[model samples]
Target: MTRGKLFEVAKELLNRELLDKDKCYMLDCHTEIFVWMGRCTSMTERKSSISATEDFLRNEGRSTSTHVTLLTEGLETARFKSNFVNWPKKEELKLYEEGRGKVAAMFKQHGYDVKELLEDDHEPLINCRGTIKVLQVNSGEAYLIPLPDQSKLFSGDCYIVQYTYPGKGRDENLFYAWFGRASQMEDRVDALSHMYAIADSTRGFPTLAQVYQDNEPEQFFSVFQTLIVFKGGKSSRYKKLIAETGMPDETFDETKTALFRVQGKNSNNMQAIQVDQVSSSLNSSYCYILQTGLSVFAWIGNLSSTEDHELLDRMIEIINPTWQPVSIREGSEPDIFWQALGGKTEYPKEKKVKQYIEGPHLFAVTLIEGRQRILKEIYNFTQGDLTTEDVLILDCQSELYVWIGRLSSVTSKEAHILGQKFLEMDILCEGLPQETPMYMVVEGQEPPFFTRHFSWDPSQAIMHGNSFERKLSLLKGGSQQSEVSVRNSWPAGSRGGTPEGSRRNSISSNGRAKSASPIPNVLGVISCTSENQLPYSPSPAEVKLFAGSSPQNGSSDDSLAFASSPALQPMVPPDNVRVDQVEGSDASDNLSIYPYERLKVRSVDPVTGIDITRREAYLSEEEFREIFGITKTAFYQLPKWRQNKLKMSLHLF
Candidate 1:
């Protein structure tokens, strides 16, 4: 095989998000088959038939000059090799039939029951006969059904044999799920290479072959670059330019070289390289998934930047003027640098400031001090870290809470609930745990002191790490400590227990409070308790409707709870806006891509009622008031579906 072609093949394989090494080799082998074919095609007539090449391939171990082209994309190497292993010349069938006794004798030697043989699609030269029993396929790869006494083959070790004419389809090929052994495959591989050489000798290279061959291996197959198969546009012209310069020559004119667009797989905002960067092919798909998910959060700001710092400061100053900064750390390191009160002690040693990992960002708060403290204690106890995690509390209830935190090696169910909430809010969180581990080390000890990790609350050992647990002297609260339970501060209307609106909002990386409380009218925090009661609230329906599906799971919650509706949710003024400028018009004056899309509920009179099907079913708030009997003020204030409809329409447009 040409080293240049091998490098190209490797480059193509790397660009995929393949998870395992085996896939890499499989793809590599398949690429060799293609490359071999390419070499043969270079010397052939341009209009060679795919079938002629296929026939050459089937003439196993034979070398002859027969020019032809074959469409081989998407076929596994083993399968492709199998197709050529037993090529049947038209004269061979009569001879084989005459020696039926010999055929049955060979089958008996091979341990296959002669009775099991059956008729199959025939090649012109041989009346093929074989029985193919598909065993099973898991995760996409298929295996052959073994004899009653034998085990099925392992993944990547299986092969198939098939016969097909160029004009006829794959069905014409005599397909087999079982092969003789490894030695047989080696023979097949050699035959395939020779056949490809003969076939390609008659046909010429694809248009851009020269360009692909000329560049340096790294330039042609670098981790940071992508392999693009030009299908349309000025691709032919670009190929001509490359051919003129030769493959290895530098022909870097933008107009002449086909643009490498990130529009293909794993393209993230046009910057990501196209080919798989990792050696293993298994990670290829995930590369795309990860890029798409993270692109949404890529431009988010952290506290390190002056602008982000100012924004964070302004947010905290407006939202929690009374809140004090408490320095919490895991492993004696602060994951978050430059907290409101704490500064870095060591550079790279203590913590490195990165965008998402242990970085500070402005966020809304939901829980008060006590609940925040409890959640933090739980996080520390469960995660086994003492420094470098931050949290922001959003809102909480009896069973669930909403919060934000840095990724944890271990996360609570409570943390996952927060993750779900963040997902709802269009925030992507990675590494949130689903179930708590059985054993967690508290203050660096083994078994006896170990505590079962809880999703929302930390174990008893964790509480000991916090100052409150020390004061309460509840390190070993006997049965109370062992029971999975939540403690309520009993003084009614007092801030002792979770405040009236106090629920465990989320915490950051180290499980520290993300925000101090859920107080409304605060610029950066949500309210735990509202001063105004909701009006004419509709009772939640026992029967649930499929509101929407989560990306991971498409399940509908049968029991839904009512909290503050999106309409009741406070809307803060935009920190930035999009604008366009022209000679006559200032860019800053223009609105964003779609300014009309905003959430606003429209109400209509029951008597006049909207024609759900006609008359432009959706109504703006003003239209809602005009058509509905309700007053303008009431229309805007209406909650539930009315408010949700507005938010939906605005977001879509």
Candidate 2:
């Protein structure tokens, strides 16, 4: 713990626990050496970090060209951050959210109508997938270097790498200002000036980020096929000799041996981050895919979920469709598998879950007028956060749900993908376990598990109940050739419990029962017989809602007399049909039975979400949508039970 000395606090795969703010340590990561100095460490340790790392590595018999990195406790680089199971990016994401929030608020203040933003002026982030350009500084000036291979880099000189996209003038491209280990102050100043100048040349659309040479983040390395760093750059005396002899251009078939750690669950948000193709890179808690020449090996960790097998299988289909993968369980690795991965060395054998740090966070994907979408953070995860137009991402720590709005655009269906991209680009979901579960919940199909996060009435939709059928049983109306019942297209599973309903479900290939989101109920059509059943009379509330007034003493047949109605006159009955009136019925009693012309028929199958628009046929489709504040198509798409409630709420029963 002393400032002048270097100590190894822990070895091999490291986690956040090893990063105490009170301690300073030298990390030996096989390929690279990093010195972590806590804020409380003495200035001597901070100043001697470079010397200490070199001296320590030399004494340990490591090579002279070993990648060296220096990191402060609070200001750790992305490379250092990704070593842990979950790295909380709360502060970073929060800052980005604040900036986005300000820009988004302007849109909201102006009514979210940004359709005027030229279509040519907008582009998706995917457009930023072009070549990466690297520039090295020489004598307070910068010049482009031959970087045909992304691995071309030297430690003696600072560089500015510009990652460009198709719409170079429309959006901001990322500018990485790299400060090399042996680079001088003049080199850094020149690189920075060039970075800003380059940004300005591109209409100031490129933002600069200062980075270290050997300690680039995972995102930084993703732009390159492989990174090969030389010991010295233009400033070193050996540079001429090295250039003349081509002494240290190390060569290896990087593609022949590669390993990628798979994080996040469900294929949509899953990320396969390439790690050093060594045994120590294997963490017991996560899954990995190894590539050996043309062979693909999916090493399933004992702690990995069944979904890992599926995700890996799908990944194989994408990455190496021609070759069949050899699936190896953690404890049952074959000799050939070990040979391909160098050797079966020591690794983290136990699955470790990080302790929960923050509560659930909610984010929304707001679609502006020009069909462009912006992901903004919501302050709270309440019922109001789930709007009909936005795709909301509810990050509930262990699980995540992408809530698709009923009226959301077709592009919004990709919320799962967009949400993950937003989190990845902003590094907001750093430190989160790679296998954290993510599921999509469409508007009406919200499962109880998803709905529980919001504040709303748990009262089940009344349409799903048999109350309507029960109501008919109390009447003298005939149903000889008819039967009224609910047909739920999808069962609304029990609250806080897995559904054991008779819905057809398939087990995952791994034989583990995967948890699923419950499907909401829908309405089905009812069948009727020759017997005439009395039609459902409008309720007092329904009368007030539709007619603008209720009948005087609405409970009595006399007061609700159809003959005196302003809208329509009562229909006349056939000769064979007899008019039956309740004799001396109480004034408080409603019309339970009525004599009608033929059989009055109206359908209400809210339980099984049937599209029985006939009940409200009197109103035009436009009027229905306008009055109820829901599109006709959207309303029809809802479960019969849900449709019933919405129609009932805005309408008369």
Candidate 3:
């Protein structure tokens, strides 16, 4: 036979064997089989045919290759090598048949019925039983069911499978299926069997691949064309299916009329416009139902096509207006999906409060005072040393004082209500009884204690040490004698007492006081003699009589007698002693009899000669106000009593 005729013969044999046995095969079956044939067939037509036949039998491992060698000596021998070839044995054919039976049974198990076709018979075009029908493609008269509605069929399509269920009559059943694009009959059969197997395992048709392509258009756009599939019919159960698939409600007008555009990866801003209704080319001719009772169909081309609109209308009418197209934008809030998938949502932000005051008015008095008081109370109640520039003076109900100044220098007392600006001032002014006397000195005023009060005698002023001893002795009465009393009791001309010629020397020949002694102690002696002349020697008993009468315990007669004594008269410096020298000289250096000898003294007038060192003469609130020229309203506004208590508590009096 010719090479073409021999190839035809091989192809016919393969087709007949596969059709009869129903064995699954891979793609490129023709190429593989023919390529093998071409390799062994290059001799005479008959020998080539035989060689081709031998290779096929050997290739399938059903038989071995054969060889005959001739000898020149007439000793002929025929040997069968291990590569001997022969036709398929009965046992091999039986095994193939058995395998075919198992495959058919498996297809049935998966809800697909395999039907073989005869050479002269035409495969039915309509789905009468409404059951899944898989056409055996190897048969010469294999079925050629048209593509389902909206389903695109490319060239070389082989498998024509159907999914459907029985209804009231032959024409009333639903149908659906996938038209495969496999080129070879063997490949078509393999695909159909695999699809059924998947369906059995998944409990549904193998539509996952189709749905995946639909969702991921960007990835699969170049590989396959996308389509919008729909289905409808009486007794169709698709409500749950529609919802699960995220389809829009059937009541949507565009969905009912199929008035929409399907956006693909390459399309932009495709508008959904209404189109006139028309009949669908795929209606009734190419649809099916699965064992799952899902009636499905698809539109192969654009949804904007008139055929798709008509198909949508027909589906709506048949399915009682319950069939709907999927809405890409429909479903739970978009954020909900993102949240379910661990995405974040944006929310409004909160506002912040301001920190510092900026105007000349300072902070609001009420609020700032309240806050400051609370802070002060915390520190004060805890006895904490923490201090702040803001100060607050609070009683049981309200703040009596508030002040703010330089932050760094505020003392603990002022930290509660006053600022650092008052550090140099007497701001320790709280916690005293209301009856206590105090004063408030603001900026630009000196404390009353520091102000010079001219109503005192400098010449008669004694050192603090001597003054303290004198006061103590007077309080206890001179009957309790000590060294101080002995020193003061010495005769007038003694070393520690007034000198004999001091008074005579202080008086010049002009009868004016001579220049006072430069030594303050000698000057004191002169001042004393100039004021009073004591008896040349005063005995201890006389000294006791003079010093024993104290204001606290002395009888009025004793006070009168002591006041009348010349020794008790206020001392006056001689006229020659410069007043300015006495006032400006460091009294501490001259009065070195005390431990605090460096302390300065405030000069006093000779006439009044008040002992300003006495606590009783310290400035009172009324006296302070008078001295500083402060108003009553302003003075009372402060916590005057508390201020005094704080100063006293701090030993700052």
Winning model by TM-score: 2
The better candidate by lDDT, 2 or 3, is 2
lDDT of 1 by residue, 1-653 (tens): 22111222344323312222221111222212221222122212212322233343455433332221122112122222322323221111111122334433543563322321222221112222322232322222333435441222211122232222221111211222222122123332332333223223322110000011111112112211222222221123333434675743222222322111122112111122222212221121111111111121011121123333233333223222543433222233233322211333331111111111221222332222111111221221222223212233321110112222221112232333343443343211222222111111112111111111122223333232122222223423321222111122211110011112222224433233443221122222221223342322111221112243221232234111122212122222221222121211122133222112221223332213322211222444444343443443554455322432232322211
Instruction: Sort by lDDT, best first.
Output: 2, 3, 1
- Give the per-residue lDDT digits (tens) of candidate 2, residues 1-653: 45556765665566677776666677676776566766465555555665666677778898865655555454454455656656656422111223233433443453321111111211122333567788878877777877654445666667778876443123325667777665667777677677766765663223345566534433445444344454356743335445787776222243456677765435433445456678998987678878787777889987677876776666556544676777889999888788877888998765442222223556655433222233445542355445544566776555556776544542222443544443343334344443344455555444434554554432221112222221222243533221111122222322232222211122211122322211111101111112222122222322121122222322222111122222111122122322242112131133222212111232242322211222333344555455555555555554443443334333323
What is the Å distance of residue 178 in model 2 from its true position?
Answer: 6.0
Q: Which regions of candidate 3 fall more than 4 Å away from where they truly are?
A: 1-145, 148-214, 217-226, 229-235, 239-255, 265-653
Query: What TM-score would each prediction reach against the true structure?
Result: 0.16, 0.28, 0.12
lDDT of prediction 2: 0.48
Q: Comparing candidate 1 with candidate 3, which one achieves the higher TM-score?
A: 1
Score residue 545 of candidate 3 by CA lDDT: 19
Clash counts for the predictions, in order: 68, 18, 34
Instruction: Sort by TM-score, best first.
Output: 2, 1, 3
At residue 93, give the lDDT of candidate 3.
13
lDDT score, residue 597, model 3? Answer: 14
Ten contiguous residues minimizing lDDT sum, candidate 2: 518-527
lDDT of 3 by residue, 1-653 (tens): 34423233332224223311211112123212111211122224323433444455466564231221111111111110111133222111111223334433543453321221111212222222333443323332344434443222322233333344322121111111233222333434444454444344432111211111112212122222233323221111233434577854332222243322233222211111111122221112121111111222223231133443444444333333444422122122234333322443331121111111100111111111111111112111110111112222222110122222112222222222222121122112222222121111111111111111111222122112222233333444432222211111322110122212222222322233323221121000011122122112211222221224322343233221222222221112122311122221133233312111111132232213323222222334454344323433443343433222222212222
By TM-score, the better pick of 2 and 3 is 2
